[model samples]
Target: MIDVKIFQTPSGEYTGFQMSGHAGYAEYGQDIVCAAVSALVINAINSIDQYTEDAFENSVDPDSGSVFFQITDRPVSTSSQLLLKSLVLGLNGIQDEYGKKHIKIRLEKQEG
Candidate 1:
């Protein structure tokens, strides 16, 4: 299953997100759930990089099928925030379609 954790600030703003694990719905190359999740996340990351000036930190652990991203040293810009929200929307759609065993999403709160 693909596990996605969205981090929210105390005031309920999205601070970042961490996604790990594979859907295992099918083989790696053919898993629709994996493809959908990857498309949503990668598109968001790319959009943030291209359209926003928010300084940030991001890392990927291939061995663990994990990716982590967080805005660093500053608040996220409007464009980045939009992209992040879009990502969550897409992820939720996937979860609804594929069900929990294939893709799971949870929210985590972070104190200021």
Candidate 2:
């Protein structure tokens, strides 16, 4: 199953997200769940980079199917916030369609 962690501030603002594991719904190349998750994540990252001035840190591990993206700048920009929110929405939709067996999403409070 794909595990997703969405980090948020006390006031409910998004700060970042981390994703790991494969959907195992099908073979790697044919897993629609994984594809949908990848598309949303990549699009959100690219959109934030291209459309906003927010600074972020990201790391990807193909071997482990792990990805981590964090906004490094404080008081995140509205554009970046919206992009991340869209990502969360897309991910949730995938989870709802594919079921918890394929994907799991959890909300986490950002640590100091």
Candidate 3:
């Protein structure tokens, strides 16, 4: 099971993402989930032509059966938004539990 959260600026400019969950087939494991999320994030970053560097900021284990991923970077265009949505949807579709998990994408602008 994996939970994903995406944050975007109000002007629809910058975006960030956080994903956490279990990776293994029988039991949810952080190692598997971390690797999978890492790959997904990398692929997403590569899909955008304008993005120079999009990488994971941190991966922490606050407890057992849980891992965290923080991805931050600029997206080139609206296409980038659509690409992220699709990527998240695809990741969630991997399992039935994932389908039931809650995923959030929020858009907000930078404060002056």
Off by over 4 Å in 2: none
Query: Could you tell which candidate, 1 or 3, scores higher by TM-score?
Result: 1
Clashes per candidate, residues 3 or more apart or on different chains: 0, 0, 5
Candidate 3 lDDT by residue in tens digits, 1-112? 4455655555654355555555443443445444555567657756643453455454555353233333444443466666666666655655333334332223334421
Q: Name the best candidate (by TM-score).
A: 2
The list of candidate 3 runs beyond 4 A from truth reads 8-14, 26-38, 49-76, 95-112
The residue-level lDDT of candidate 1 at 36 comes to: 81
lDDT of each: 0.86, 0.92, 0.50
Instruction: Residues 46-89, candidate 2: write the lDDT tens digits.
Output: 99999999999999998888999999898999989899999999
Q: Give each model a TM-score.
A: 0.93, 0.96, 0.44
Off by over 4 Å in 1: none
Decreasing lDDT order of the candidates: 2, 1, 3
Span of 10 residues, lowest total lDDT, candidate 1: 71-80
Cα-based lDDT at residue 65, candidate 1: 76
Q: Of 1 and 2, which scores higher on lDDT?
A: 2
Model 1 residue pairs with clashes: none
